[model samples]
Target: MSHPVDIHVGRKLKQARTLRRMSQTDVARHLKLSFQQIQKYEIGSNRIAASRLYDLSRILDVPTAYFFEGLGDAPEVGARDHGLDIVSAVASIKDEQVKSRIVTFIEDVSGRTVAKSA
Candidate 1:
């Protein structure tokens, strides 16, 4: 029935993956699943088990709690919001530092930094 928490987590997963500039195939390879499964997970069509989610957190270099942040007041999340491919936008950068700086610049420009939320 697509629980809201599951949807939120999936959206967060997609965001984190994009921030890391990973493809669905990349994450799927780590999780030992098909890329289609990654797509399902990202869209909340399937729930990620705790252990698998933990493994994904490790692979994605994010804390386990990260996927749960900003949940209570979060807006509706899914691929339907303009179907934007955020990963491709960041994937062109080969330099990690450059990518990090770009992400920071985006956060600053969007005024959605952690301090603003706080």
Candidate 2:
């Protein structure tokens, strides 16, 4: 049986995708899946496989744990915060090339800093 968590994950996925102004077809193409599969996932009609979920997390620019963040929340607790954080961060990254350079720069700096401190 599919866990209720699947629905939560699906909702988060849908929210993130919509906020990014991306289509189900865009995500499906990136994940090498059919748009129908993406649709099923977004609506929680199907459970996402672990591997696919991980891929979705990356494509959505969220932590893998993002889907599980509000699983135990009260109705008052919102899942929109982290999803919005991702959307806002992504939107501010207006240049794809600059984004790539920034990621590479951060990775390199962090790697060297950690290595030197070790």
Candidate 3:
């Protein structure tokens, strides 16, 4: 059985990759590994080494700690949570104007006002 931590990390990896709009093939090419290897990593079928994890953090433009975020509260791997995915995708937007507009739109649709960022 895969360790829960491994599964959590794999799920985070997939989340970050998807939020960045990267395909497994793109990540594999950067790591010089086969796409199947990337799939294995994402599925927790194979454990990633620390060095490779560091490389992945760099490639994915996320802090290494990002892979461990919410590990204590994580759900089972492959669980569907579209709300979190949507938040993550919105958070990953680089353009401030676009992000602000999206946030406004979300607030309007939800009938809630989010505090403006200083």
Candidate 4:
């Protein structure tokens, strides 16, 4: 049976992959696994082993803890997809300056203005 944490982590993996604009086949080729395995992992139909998760973190350029970031809330699927969309938008930024501006804008929109670092 699939546990809640597994489902959540799977969603995180999918989100990271999507933001990277990576296909399941690409990830599978990198990890030497079948594309079906990656699909199963994304859907939580198959649990990811710790070693594989570590590999994924490196390949996806996220910390291992990223997969558990919002575990407490157990975000709904729609919320997860929306989060992915936002992450994808941010990841598409090619310039650090532009990305920082977007971050600052988002902070302002959220009513919390954080000072920019020098």
Root-mean-square deviation of every model: 6.6, 8.2, 7.3, 6.7
CA lDDT of each prediction against the hidden true structure = 0.78, 0.72, 0.81, 0.81
What TM-score number comes out for model 4?
A: 0.67
lDDT of 3 by residue, 1-118 (tens): 8887887788888877765557789899999999999888888988989999999998887899988888777667988868557867876889979987887898799997644411
The number of the candidate with the highest TM-score is 1
Residue pairs with backbone overlap in model 2: none
- Sum up the clashes in candidate 1: 0
Q: Itemize residue pairs with steric clashes in candidate 4.
A: none
* Ranked by TM-score, top first: 1, 4, 3, 2
The residue ranges of model 3 lying beyond 4 angstroms of the native Cα positions read: 74-80, 83-118
**Tens-place lDDT digits, model 2, residues 14-85:** 766755457789899999889999999977889998999899888877788877887887665553556456
Deviation of model 3 at 3, angstroms: 0.8
Q: Is candidate 1 or candidate 3 better by TM-score?
A: 1
lDDT of 2 at 111: 75
Better of 2 and 4 by TM-score: 4
Residue-level lDDT of model 1, residues 4-118, one tens digit each, is: 8888889888887776667889889888899999998888989999999999989887899988887776456652433235555665778979977877887888786422100
